[model samples]
Target: MTIRMIGRHIREGLKNMWRNGWMSFASVSAVAITLLILGAAMVVALNAEQLSTYVTGELEINVYLNQQVTDAQGQQVAREIDQLSGVKSVQYISKEEGFKRLKKMVGTQYASFMESVNSGNTLPVQLVVKAANPRETTKVAAEILSVPSVHNIQDGENVLGKLFSFLNAVRDVGLAFVIALIITAMFLISNTIRLAIFSRRREIEIMKLVGATNWFIRWPFVWEGILIGVLGAAIPFAIIAYGYQFLYHYSGGAFVALSFPLMKAGLVAHKIGGILFGIGIIIGLWGGIMSVRRFLRI
Candidate 1:
């Protein structure tokens, strides 16, 4: 509690670590390895979720108009669809524009084939609808289908459904893996701390015989555990920060082919640093408490 008591605990903790050099190294190594795995997993999970979101946000609904629909009727339909709930924006593409776009897509080799069609630009006028919320694309598409000039709709419902399902599965699996790793890490750390304290059992008994309070005897080992945790987490934190920065820069801002963008390196590092530090402290304290309690049998 007092400064002097804190200083004594820290000094004793350092002495204990030195006294059992091999065991101390093992404990620190265990902590570092566990935290490193956790940090890497966090990075992957965060980026995967972001990529899923980016792809979802690009989804759109295409409403094709009937061949006989007049320009005025098409404009009216666009106005009505834009007013619908969950609709973000609606742009009308005339039949002529659609034909030009098709021609551009087919390239020079197929230009003659498109020109041979005798139906005189049979491509239907279309209203491209963007949803304010990606999850509501189906709902917005349904509303657009009810509009007067809308002959049909292509909302990619099946593809979006599969995408959402895959993302959810990834999230669930990542969560489960993290939980398993945490449990395993705690178990290993607790056992290592117990072994470290077991070697000092005689000293603890001697302190008790000399009328030292249990709190006084326990503080040093607790500090030792905390130190191990902090030391283990430190290297992983540095590695993650530097590695992520390199990766972000190397990938150039966005992976255009995948339609995914990495979060700013500084922001990701800051958040992950806080998380690793907090977890380190908690695991250290927990291992200490468990080890001390088992040894003291109190």
Candidate 2:
């Protein structure tokens, strides 16, 4: 289309919106409410997924060596574990350091009890193994147990299994909910645009009766639909951005105590805002084309 043609289409679109003020308001309002629900759900689902990732990354396996293993042997075992397929890193912890950690954990009440353990450190040296992937921790732990001088492995297998299972379930449920909301939003927007078109059926027929092509008659309404979507999306995007920023500022390091750091507000807003705008534009354009096609029968 020429620039003049495109300019005319835009002017006509704006004129129609002004002429049909009540219907335009109704259409824009419907889109705004639908996008608001969608925006909220997206924020929640993204945050939950991030939290799951953070927790999974923290999971580690502890491989305890036999008490008789020398420092040289321990270093060799650490190197061997490091070369394993799923192992991300291996840190060798000596018995002395382990004893001190145990004492610190047990506190002053058990300090004397820990020191009286036969005047010699009974704790075995350990190789702290972090897996490249949390899901492969069990396999990595099993492989480490077969290594020479490795007496035992403590991978928190049971707790980690349950944690991962729960996280997976949460992710699936959140995805399902978001999909349902999107479908509902599309249905609502389509119906609203259809009603708006119905109100202007006569104008469309008059244009068709003239020498105007079907596309010429259709472009204005399509632009109107897109404008409604953009206006609708703008409100929710602003609201969500402001609300997230406020929450992040006032959260007071509470989430840090829970071991799941909240994502930065600016980053979240940028990602989520782009998604919202894209969704709005898609729904608007889709609803416009669908409604016009159904009504015009062209």
Best model number under TM-score: 1
Per-residue alpha-carbon lDDT of model 2 for 90-168, expressed as tens digits? Answer: 9889878888888888899877787788268777888889999887888989999998899998888787568668867
Candidate 1 residue 185 Cα shift, in angstroms, is 1.9
Candidate 2 residue 125 Cα shift, in angstroms, is: 3.0
Candidate 1: count the clashes: 0
Question: Looking at candidate 1, what is the lDDT of residue 182?
Answer: 63
Model 2: per-residue Cα lDDT at residue 85:
94
Measured with C-alpha atoms, the lDDT of residue 103 in candidate 1 is 87
For candidate 2, the 10 contiguous residues with the lowest summed lDDT are 252-261
Best by lDDT: 1
11: Cα error in model 2, Å? 4.6
Give the per-residue Cα lDDT of candidate 1 at 49. 70
Q: Worst ten-residue run, lDDT, model 1?
A: 181-190
lDDT of 1 at 80: 85
